[model samples]
Target: MAAAARLAWVDATSGVAGDMLLGALIDAGASLPAIRAAVESVIPAAVALSVDEVSRAGLRAARLRVEPLIESPPHRTWRSIRALIEDAELPEPVRDRALAVFGRLAQAEGRVHGVSADEVHFHEVGAWDSIADVVGVCAALHSLGISRLSASAVALGSGRVRTAHGEIPVPVPAVLELSAGWQVVSGGAGELATPTGLALVTALASECGALPPMSLESTGVGAGTRDTPGRPNVVRVVVGTPVAEGGRDELVLEANVDDLDPRLWPGVLAALLAEGASDAWLVPILMKKGRPAHTLCVLAPVERAAALREAMFRETSTIGVRETAVRKTALERTWVHVPLLGATVPVKVAHRDGEILQATPEFDDVAALARKLGMPVRTVLEAAVAAAVDQHLIPGAELP
Candidate 1:
């Protein structure tokens, strides 16, 4: 089985900036030379990266500065950036990540200006520093092998900040566009979150909340250009591997629906999951006065509970939802793929004390294999389990 994914959770409690993100990665042990090289490989301008150890609000952090050789930089469009990334010699994942971040920025700007993302002209973020910051962050994340990105509630400072469009309000139009469904709070004065930072985080972070279950490895603080009054204007990134905790809290959102037709159950479940529900299911129940109904249940991280509820309300005929805090425990699990009938069948193995406890083929994979092989799902499942055993995926263990 492939090892579990390593994650980096950006703590944007103060705020996030492009330079601040790069500085944080540098502080977290990302190679400065490597990041500079990657950024140079993708941009036409001669890029200079300087990383200095600086103290912000009495807390030590890394400060990254980008100096470009070119003068009178030309404004760029989404298409041009895409072409630049596609033609660059950087790693594929890094290129894709940088492109994704920029794409989000373009999309937000496009939505604000009523243009398509591909045709949107990046007025401010098209500059050299913006490009370098986005690319360097992507390269650093790739170098650290961070496959998953998460964040805490973002903190946006108060007041107006100057942009290409003259004086604009704090948490600019682009920030609002990028933050449609995300959690953000305002703190202090001045522009804390920039379009570059907001786009990067919203585009990349798969989940946002309090620190998830992880074993701590390293933490880095990236300082913003200007220091805030009380706290250091910085964004912190925490890198670690996910581990199953003994006991954890989750929010359970439930809604009883008897009026909704059963045909739309799949769609509702899919919507809930797409909206960040950890798990969504329906259970048959009898309501008051012997009325038959189905209880739609959603288990989600508390941070995403609101989004999940909204999805449920939109997709199901549910007027009210019950939210409850729940404690849950789960075993350490690993998934391995076994080749069967010209298809890769994923087998879930649950373990305790590093010993193989039970091995079972994923039901979805089994059903797909059954359809492809013209056999029963049980038959496909049995074959996959046998193949996994033959491959010694779990030594001295029986299928459960």
Candidate 2:
């Protein structure tokens, strides 16, 4: 409930691979025995998880390997996959968490393949090894007891890939589909990216942009199985205590433009966004004269003060802009796994008095699950909330 007490960032600047990402998490201190125990509980047949130190692009990392009891099979529908994960006799917490991951993957497959959740079979995600990777990673992440996860813009390699479906162009269709709402980059020398990697990012990353400024702490590099002549083939994970509370700080910058043209306002706002201002807007008012004017307001971090102030000056006829420091009360929020409306979604819980106060499904989580189940996001949100309320897990009350 306190969010594992650590912040994690995945440096996918060079790209992310399933195994590489799993290895990176392990390197970042995800327990191997805990992961194995979790996996064994979820999988019926006996499977062995092997971890070893390995190198990729000269960076050291842990390589996760799985020895499954059955031969790998072809694509499987979400229903089958869910059956496997649920039937694994896994602990309630692990089972619930693992189900959320599969539910996300299932929804993605359903969307990409144009089939129902029960009908959509996974090509890469269904493989035993991939299952171990995905579930194992989630188990490890949960074990880390971390509250928030962030990632840099993903680096997707350029070039075609041979899949069970056939040769597809670079940035495979599934990968492209999974990255629908997130920012991604391409042009690696080799096939350093995959659909599974992108899906994992899409499902878990809270934000997909540059690394926010934070105090440096522990770093773990997950090595991929490829070796290129140049850049290292590794995924790095950085876990630390955020220097800034919630990695957010408050600052307000304002400028009055009485002599500016009306047409210039739109451009100025866009410029602020391009410069990375958290928020920028205009407030209409009457200036010294009984005339009309606009107060250009910009809310951003202190770091963007110089650039934002410069933008206002360059764009408007304002003589100067004033900067003020302000305190903001932010909710200490964390995400919870909830089953709702025939799917599992991440419910963000904000609380006080050790009592349940506010709970809402993450929009992306609801949207993704909704799109997969062919149901409206609102319906799922309602159902999830209702379920939480009924389970007496809503924070304050006992089950009726």
| Colliding residue pairs in candidate 2 | 4-145, 42-88, 76-121, 77-121
Most lDDT-accurate candidate = 1
lDDT of 2 by residue, 1-400 (tens): 2444566888898889777888888888888888887777666464688778876666667777777787755567778777777687664545544555565555566666777656876876787778777778777777776545678888887888787788878887667766665768885755667767775665555556666555656678887776665787888888776665643444677887777888888888999988768789999989885878898999864434444654665577764455555545655666677777656677777776566667766788778887888988788777777866655657554212
Clashes in candidate 2: how many?
Answer: 4
Task: Show the lowest summed lDDT stretch of 10 residues, model 2.
Answer: 391-400
lDDT of 1: 0.80
Q: Let me know the TM-score candidate 1 reaches against the reference structure.
A: 0.65
TM-score of 2: 0.60
lDDT for each candidate structure? 0.80, 0.70
Per-residue lDDT tens digits for candidate 1, residues 1-400, read: 1122667899998888888988998888888888988988988556799988888898999999888798877789988987888788998667767876786687678879899777988988888788899999988887777766788888888888887879988878888777766789996677888889987787667667888778878899999888656888999999887777455456788889999989999988888888778899999999999999999999976445434654665587664565666766777788888889887988888887777777788998789879988899888888887898887767556433
